[model samples]
Target: MTTSLVDAESVLAIEIGSIHTRALLFDVVDGQYRFIGAGRAPTTIHAPFFDISEGIHLAISHLQEITSRILLEESRLILPGKADGSGVDQVVLTYTAGQPLRVVVMGLLEDVSVESARRLAASAHTIITEAIGLNDRRPPEAQIDALLRARPDLIILSGGTDQGASRSIAKNVDLLTFALQIIPREKRPEVIYAGNHALVTPVKDVLSTYTQVHVAPNLRPEIDVENLSPAQDILADAEFHIRSRQIGGLQSYRSILAVEPLSAPFAFARMIRFLSRINNPGKGVIGVDLGAGNLIIASAFQGNSAVSVLPMGTGPGMAQALRTIPISEISRWLPIHIPESVVEDYLWHKTLHPTLLPVTTETAAVEQAAIRQVLWNGLNQHRTRYPNTPLLAEPILAAGMPLTQWSPQTSLMLLVDGLQPFGITTFVQDAHGLTAALGIISTNNAILPVQVIESNAFVNLGTVIVPLSNARYGTSILKVKVEYEAGNQISLEVRQGSVTALPIQTGQTARVHLQPLRPITIDPIGKDTTRSFKVIGGVCGVIVDARGRPLSLPTDAARRRDMLKKWAAGFGA
Candidate 1:
């Protein structure tokens, strides 16, 4: 993902979401890529304005106003920025158009070929409606019935390896061909064959009789090796067309873009690959973008990642979340006892007025409660897709307007409550929501995302330390001495079930000494026996969460509310 730009000096990226559309400008500053300016507007993709270009124009025009440099004339962008800096050198697109594409996956084995196919389909913006492998016990009739019942928009068939036996692969393709005949040609779903290179011709020749078939590279060319990028590229194109037609056709907005728009969720999921690749040893990266209509959960370790895009969120999709998240789960996070009916009513009202603000303090608390559960639910789904990332993630990032409404401290508390990260971790906020734009555009210019990441483009929310201990609540487990850059020192004795922030501020550096009284896991290395290290401070400074792993919140509602308060107060939230 690291490549230097040659001709392009100024680049403009447009990010379209369900509720908003953003335009971000990046240029070489002091011989390095840096985010220069940005503009945003309410997305006009529905109702009174069906053309996506309206929002694009508004955001770009706003960018022109901010930079005093014109990027558009009439409805088109001025490419190859002039010496006067009145335009940009290139333009790119990224957007979260709508729902995740429903897909049915079939392969030779559930854990091998089928699992690889499912990963290709499970981008942040895709949902696998059904998965059938040779291991599946259902009869041939039942398999066909299940495929039809799924009502998928796409079917991905993958099995076998390069030059491997083709009997099972051929059998799956034959079954898929039969299933397509069951549905009318007009209603038949598109198909993707990413199995053995040897079987592509036969699979395409058979499935192409019903609907368009795309032959992607073999997803599993070797038994022990896995590669999905080639197939993921095809999926991205399918997603683009699948979503573009839903909002005033793809060509309607094509003129405003220098290139075709990339799927936002997939771009974000792929971005984790870059993040996880650059991270320090022994830690992974986890990121969640909770938007009004969608939620993206992605975690990556050593370039392997799990990403899921749920079609619901805190705004327009609040009520829809109830389908996956239990009603009881949401109320448990509330600080005050509120009837389940009241919470249900809140979800309905939020769905109607997605941008509605809290009317009272109680309403505000309830809204936070719902958001916490939505994040928790998103993580739960992500865990199911890939569970090998890491027990603790470094720089766990939280993105979306829902989190921006709260202070960094409050957001960190929500992260602790929602993610329940283990061991040691750091947290940051994608405050400007430029992650999708940066991630997708990296395909064109990789320097942009890396440079922007190193810059203060993201808000650092401080590091969190969670020690593994079985000591009872209120018992001291870890001792810490925080020495700030300003020559100030503060010592703390953290007890079980406590969450607190040490004395430090953003941009400050600190050398910390740690002593564990109980059995705790802190990676040990080097010559010194002392567990001391230098750390950077965020808005909330260094955070210590002594809460038990698999976090045990109080069973009683009243006690849980009190515990939440004490935790919040510890950060001065």
Candidate 2:
């Protein structure tokens, strides 16, 4: 019986995240795996000794209770094994890291080489601790002092290409050797060199003599393009391995599985590639996933792309919202009048104690504020990072658990407002809060997650022909027209960070074009060109030509709120 139980068909895939621990039960039905039941518990990361198992066990215990109840209540007519309710088979546990892994970049130069290393570190979700270089004005003692303060988990020593310059690279090696003298052996960070391959042996001789050193292919073997895959893989391996050793509880067991620092972003990117490449190779799409600790932004245009993670999350933003912004700011969205200090205290407590339930009316109000602040912060960060990138032109798909709880109006408002800040007009969401879970599904079972995301998870915000030239704050330059079939046309002026509502009903198509105020077209990198293209609507609408810099809307609190109100009124939002 015990052996038979091990081979049972039902299985549970568990994901333990910094904010939430979830259990997803899967069972075979009609020769296909179907979702059974899911249970969630708030994660306890700051608890004594950081025992991850305590949280995992609690999550699983709830799952068992929920599944048993579901079977007893409903399985009699719908599922097999109704008598014993022996449907669950196995468990696969995965986790989202709580503490961010740090990486110190030791490059040959400050601007060129260090910049490339910084980009790679950003993509891998590694917090950069130190950026040391040969020409850097800082002394070796200052550099070492900085590294010691950071206490990074790993160091990425990168420089010149395969057969390129070696003097600058050697300087970095010498500096690292000096730093190693003061740092203890056990506490010393791991070093990864992605530089001139020829200097790898010498670097090992100097640096590896004191610390554990690994080598990967040069990040920029040539001047034009960079090859960071091998280095990225090595970094991920080192992060997970080191984290597994120090973090107690479930992480120790979970580290055995293949995990990456950008696991969620990578999962989303793979899904898009699988879908687009399989059917149409010339596909361009975008994906965004917002969570408690981080917000992931990924985009693919003309088959190649970049994905990034932002550190600002809803919980922290909400807590800070009270002190930084006005409580009346949040209450404006709420129906009833709530005290400022009450809301502030509620948000603060929620940030410090995320797992607790909102037991009172004020607490609920604070939750709304926190949730709104979270979405707002993410959009703000995206706009700041990719200032040249226009949001309204591209369909930005957002997936998150909070989106599931929001009323459609509130959700729509948040989505529209968030995008309005960046000029993102169109929106998509997994209303069921299933995108992250589906990410795991796409990994284990192919094609299914894509189908589900396409069919149920994503929603089209709307289509509008946003001229590139008019993609600036306070500039309403180009005119937009959606020509419907019955000689009907809807027109609106282009406004940054605002969505125009045309009465084009669902399931109907319209022709969209941008009558640019200036002769303009936008390149794939979002730069304005002296050329123009016919308007097209897909994930991202046509990249119209624009003259001025990308929208530089104000971030001043009052000014922004006023601008937001005006834009919201433009769409009757």
Best by TM-score: 1
Pairs that clash in candidate 1: 124-309
Show model 1 residue runs off by greater than 4 Å: 1-8, 130-150, 178-187, 220-229, 252-260, 486-488, 523-530
Assess the local accuracy of residue 315 in candidate 2 as a C-alpha lDDT between 0 and 100. 56
Give the distance in Å from residue 551's predicted Cα in candidate 1 to where it truly belongs.
1.5
TM-score of 1: 0.90
Candidate 2 per-residue lDDT over residues 229-263, each given as its tens digit: 56655665665566665557655555433323234
Q: Model 2, 213: alpha-carbon shift in Å?
A: 3.6
TM-score of each: 0.90, 0.71
Q: List the candidate 2 regions with Cα displacement exceeding 4 Å.
A: 1-12, 26-36, 64-94, 202-214, 254-265, 268-283, 317-350, 353-395, 402-404, 420-426, 440-444, 454-500, 503-573
Model 2 lDDT, full chain set: 0.57
User: What local distance difference test score does each model get?
Assistant: 0.80, 0.57
Q: How many backbone clashes does every candidate have?
A: 1, 9
Model 2: residue 479 alpha-carbon error in angstroms: 9.6
